[model samples]
Target chain A: MSAKTWLPLLALAALTGCRQDMHDPPRYRAQGSSDFFSDGRVNRPVVEGTVARGQLRADTKFYQGREGGEFVKTLPVELTKDLVKRGQERYNIYCSPCHGMVGDGEGMVVQRGFRHPPSFHLERMRELPVGHYYDVITNGFGAMSSYASRIPVKDRWAIVAYVRALQLSQNATMQDVPEAERGKLSQEGRQ
Target chain B: MSQIFHPSANTIAKVSIFGAIFFAGGLLVILNEVNRSPYVTRVGVAREQPVPFSHKHHVGGIGIDCRYCHTAVETSSAAGIPPTETCMSCHSQIWADSPMLEPVRASFRTDRSIEWTRVHDLPGFVYFDHSIHLKKGVGCVTCHGRVDQMPLMYQQNTLNMEWCLDCHRAPEKYVRPREEVFRMDYRPQESQQVIGARLVKEYKIRKLTDCSVCHR
Candidate 1:
């Protein structure tokens, strides 16, 4: 072919060839592998005894759900409607599959043959301190994996608060409802 | 000179001029199509992973939320891949003995990362953040397509610059309610224009087509 024909073809080849270099620059992507690492992972493990900035987690009551040796009876964080709502959202995402939406242990995963967890309404579960639930979520309970990596500290507390709400909802009586809201419940029941 | 060129040479030259115009145009058209073709873009091609995880079975059949495994979608640049522990969270009890899940068990026991095949990889230059898009009410289905129905994960749309620009130019065309961002089967109740425009204003989603907006 003449130079006229070769020029256009050469330009096309240059365009396609140079693209690959830019497309995959010498950089690490999230969850990508690295040839330099023995494990072929780009992420390096955190060194022992060293914590990243803003991750000191010094508050034992909030972080560990324990003030001393004993589990705290009440939530360390202030209880708010938003906090419970946040907890409900996080619980549905991380815990509800196995623990059930209402904490009855009849979740979809439970129905699929996973071990049934105890109902929150049980006397034993109801009697347990709020911190006990936080410990179970931070560290795995029997047949359950630790959701610490999946759920953050505040959200874990949120899930604990929501679990409390679910327990109350299941075991509450007419007297438990507020005087103003009692009318709504009675009307709905009558209908 | 008894005609230095043949009488037909004039006709040949005329035909060549017209043919050159058509040939150049046709080449450009063919090149454009080839660039968008699956062979180049890998769209709709399901990648082979170490384990054949099915989003359909997990998300559709079981009705598990996307955030159940992808825990960082709402908070980070990368929609974090679930660790093997997430797999064992259910498989340890459900499919405890299946050969299909042996890789998962091995990974969990050995404490090695499961090398899942990466799909929907954009060029390194494009800094895409899943959190921002989701926060601004771009539903997962809008870009990822119907992942709940996909048995094996695949790239649903061409991760092309033009494709990105399509939404960047007018995000109102695709924005949904923030609550519906993770919902896979979400359909707009009203016309997309009405809902999207309302969401665009409510969410304060800007037409962020600046070069540094993504390039940086």
Candidate 2:
């Protein structure tokens, strides 16, 4: 075919090819339940009682009337047999190997070759609010890695409660022992 | 005939005219969309598993947390599968009498990691952190899809780089409470626009409209 005869064909091809743009805008779909508005003015419902995760730092206070970077939710946990049992189970699973069953940092890993994890009964840790331990577990202390993912949030709190109980175990003296338990303790060999 | 061809002005004009037309046409095509064939990387569906494991069952059913199975996701670089030891913890007593437990037991002996076929894979060039996502309130279902309903878990989302950038472009719109961590259908209770505005001011979020926010 002569070159002149192909001009219309090339022009037609160019027109078709030019319209073949692959970047068409997506269809705007309607949102239900929670709406995503495009305009700057819109309302959002922030969860009333939840804290933002991955954002809470040691320097920020999460408790009432505290305006510092430190977390302030520190209160002795209420004693419950089930809570203690749960605490013990979690402790055995994650902590016993390094801190021992009794919180002395003498578990199997330490016995074999791991470095010593500090005893929970140390005065500095003992006096620290439960949140202190929580932070350490979530963020990790010296030579330790964060356990936030290994243990669930509630379980870590439970483990902290269990650690307090272990700390008290070393502090218990004659007056602290209950009469019923003391009788059983004092009569250990007689029976 | 040779002398006649040399003196023909019509022949010279015709050839020049065609040449000019072809050159302009080529230029116009190039100026438009005259690109070479694109390079697309496509590895099709991987081999199916012997026994389908459901993200629906463990994560959706029985309320077993993601940490129960993929335990290392939070602290370690890898989000790993539970060892046979983790499985045996409950299976030792719970499923000892079941016939299906045999494959699990066999897997333990072989030291295989269940081969749990990966469905949601991202390109190697991209870096994602499960801990950060989980902590920041991106649910498992956000990208994994309705895992609770599936028996055997497969990749739920395409997980292409564009797919990731879609959310990164406007995170507040996609982000929700940590409680909704895996539910893809979850929407922020308030309007995304309002939340985004509040988030910018409250959290001091520096950049949202920036391309580098998602891309390297």
The numbered model that scores best in lDDT is 1
Candidate 2 residue lDDT tens string, A63-158: 211246555555334557777778887777677756788988876556645567788878886788777877777777775556665676667777
TM-score of chain A of 1: 0.90
Ten contiguous residues with the weakest lDDT in model 2 chain B: B36-45
Candidate 2 matches the true fold with a TM-score of 0.44
Instruction: Provide the overall lDDT of each model, using Cα atoms, as 2-decimal numbers.
Output: 0.91, 0.61
Best by TM-score: 1
DockQ versus reference, model 2: 0.03
- After superposition, which runs of candidate 1 have C-alpha atoms over 4 Å from their true positions? A1-17, B1-5
lDDT string, candidate 2, B79-133, tens digits: 6666566565445445456676676777667754444454554444344677876
Where model 2 places Cα greater than 4 Å from the true spot, the runs are A1-157, A160-191, B1-47, B97-99, B182-187, B200-216
**Which candidate number has the best DockQ?**
1
